[model samples]
Target: MMMKKTVCMGLILCGMAFGTTAQTRGSLGQSDPKAKVVLDNVSKKFKSLKSVIANFVLKVEGANNSVSDSKKGSVYLKGAKYKVVMGDQEIISDNKTSWTYAKDVNEVTINNVDQSGNSMTPAKIFTNFYDKDFLYRLNGETTEKGKVLQNIELTPTDKSKTFFKVLVDVDKKNQTLARMKVFEKNGNRYTYEISSFTPNGAVTDDMFTFDAKKHPGVEVVDLR
Candidate 1:
């Protein structure tokens, strides 16, 4: 369940990071201008796209750097709507309502979108959230599979957060996000690798909502 929740949050973060204009509350004292420029380009590239479809792999590693679990998933995003499919869980949101479906139990839970406080909703974590939440600096570039990637290291300003540091890898050639790694205070690391990203993909509005009728014997739990 924790992994599912993390994936859901990561998907929402990715969708928002590229889908909308980011809000900046001014840069921190240690923030690097070079990293900001790279992030700005990424935001511009994503905002110009009509829609996005991405295939990603999630890896969970222990403190000792041993892989404990891994999962492959895909995310579909269009405007404020998104659908994430990973393993037996599917989280669908139409910007207003959300449905979490668990295939193993054949149950789906529905709830209204929460927009209050510091909720991890896309509305709250829109593009360039690092500008508001963390102090970031450029960590230079690295090559992976012949593609040049710009790496940026980020530290949270608020120590109360679960994750203490985040590493972002941007595809320098395309100015798109290629990967992200989150280091938690509890000695756990979560890495998300974007295996493939498709921009301006064809998508339908109906795809952002759950259709209980399609799943026979599936129980519905509405929390709205």
Candidate 2:
């Protein structure tokens, strides 16, 4: 009778241990639990960030041995509308009307009225997370420049086409977003590094509005 009681106790303990392990991995692979922890901090930190304008240096490496380019310019993003002025080529997305204007080419490309997840601009990290339906996962972690970071991936449950996967390097200590990597469907990869962040700044809706009349000499060709 003593032997049987001991065996039953061991089996019960094993079953309980297995149940705990399975429940933990149900959220993710249990590799980087801190990734989920950092994402949860986003909404709380930026609740006061309504609109922002920032200057950023961008480096783009296209996958499949495509054209690799580097860009340095200013970005003006207000609410869901934004305009990126890089060289003479301007990208303006007004939520309702998305337009890409190239001065050298003298052509304007118009996007669909209801384009989803099209805005992967750097500013999205500050403003767009307020939406409630984003899905997150802890991909893994890596050490960059001697700083330990957790690679957190986000997939929008509503709409997105900017990339197939987005991997963000989250600071292990401060839980702040350090850098981000985007893998697009066209085999192009974009890596963005945030140097400085100014939260709760002054930004007006007019900053997002694009007026062709402002640039009278530049030709605008609508390619919707």
Candidate 3:
């Protein structure tokens, strides 16, 4: 499978690297400081977010002349454990196995840390960002929904399942993440609107486990 297809299953799993202003992108050393500040600051904030729950809306634009579509969903995370539901499509990570459910196809794909190529894990992206395969860039600041945000860009460090540049919107003053955009290699794009953050909430470890009996009719299609 193509890397874009793999990461597309985990939109937020979209990783970061480097870029210039909103208009330009290049090597990390050449990245604009303005964008770098946001990326660096946001990375710090996300690292501090041990657990959170929130809902968001996702919009995806396809490349290859494909059409665009939108999905409304909820994302919940407790440490590395998370669950995201985009309309009928769902993704759940228990920190052990990542289960992605596609209602449209009645399919469930299962993957662990090693087999997942580490690209499907969003938190891992932050943990290994220091790797030399990537660079950083800074854009400018803008206001989105009453919040002052700094726009930062990230590029990939290596060639994997996907290689798409990422744009992260950070809260300039509070050093929080507001949103992100994933530029896919296939010419498709995805934008994430993050809202309703409940920091340091209660999330149990059981939420990450895969229980086919609990989901009942939900088929467990272990792709791995």
How does model 2 fare in lDDT? Answer: 0.54
RMSD of each: 4.2, 17.6, 5.4
By lDDT, is 1 or 3 better?
1
lDDT of 3 by residue, 1-224 (tens): 22233354555554322221232224335555665555666567777887766666677887874878776776677766777766666678877677877766565778775443434355544433423344556666788678887777766554453545777777677676667787877787777776666666677777666667766577665656
Off by over 4 Å in 2: 1-33, 62-68, 110-112, 115-150, 153-165, 171-176, 184-188
Candidate with the greatest lDDT versus the true structure: 1
Q: Is candidate 1 or candidate 3 better by TM-score?
A: 1
| Per-residue lDDT of candidate 1, residues 140-202 (tens digit) | 999999999999997776656667788999999988889888887879887888899898888
Misplaced by over 4 Å in model 1 are: 1-28, 121-126
Predicted candidate 2 versus true structure: per-residue lDDT over 1-224, tens digit per residue: 22322321222112111111112333432333455566766544544456555555455776776768665555565566666666665666667776666665555556654455533443446433423434567777788788888777764343334445667776676555566666766787665555545554576666555676866775554546
- What's the true lDDT of residue 127 in model 1? 45
Off by over 4 Å in 3: 1-8, 15-34, 63-66, 103-107, 115-117, 125-132, 157-164
Instruction: Work out the TM-score per prediction.
Output: 0.85, 0.59, 0.73
Task: Give the alpha-carbon lDDT of every model.
Answer: 0.74, 0.54, 0.62
Cα lDDT for residue 165, model 1? 82
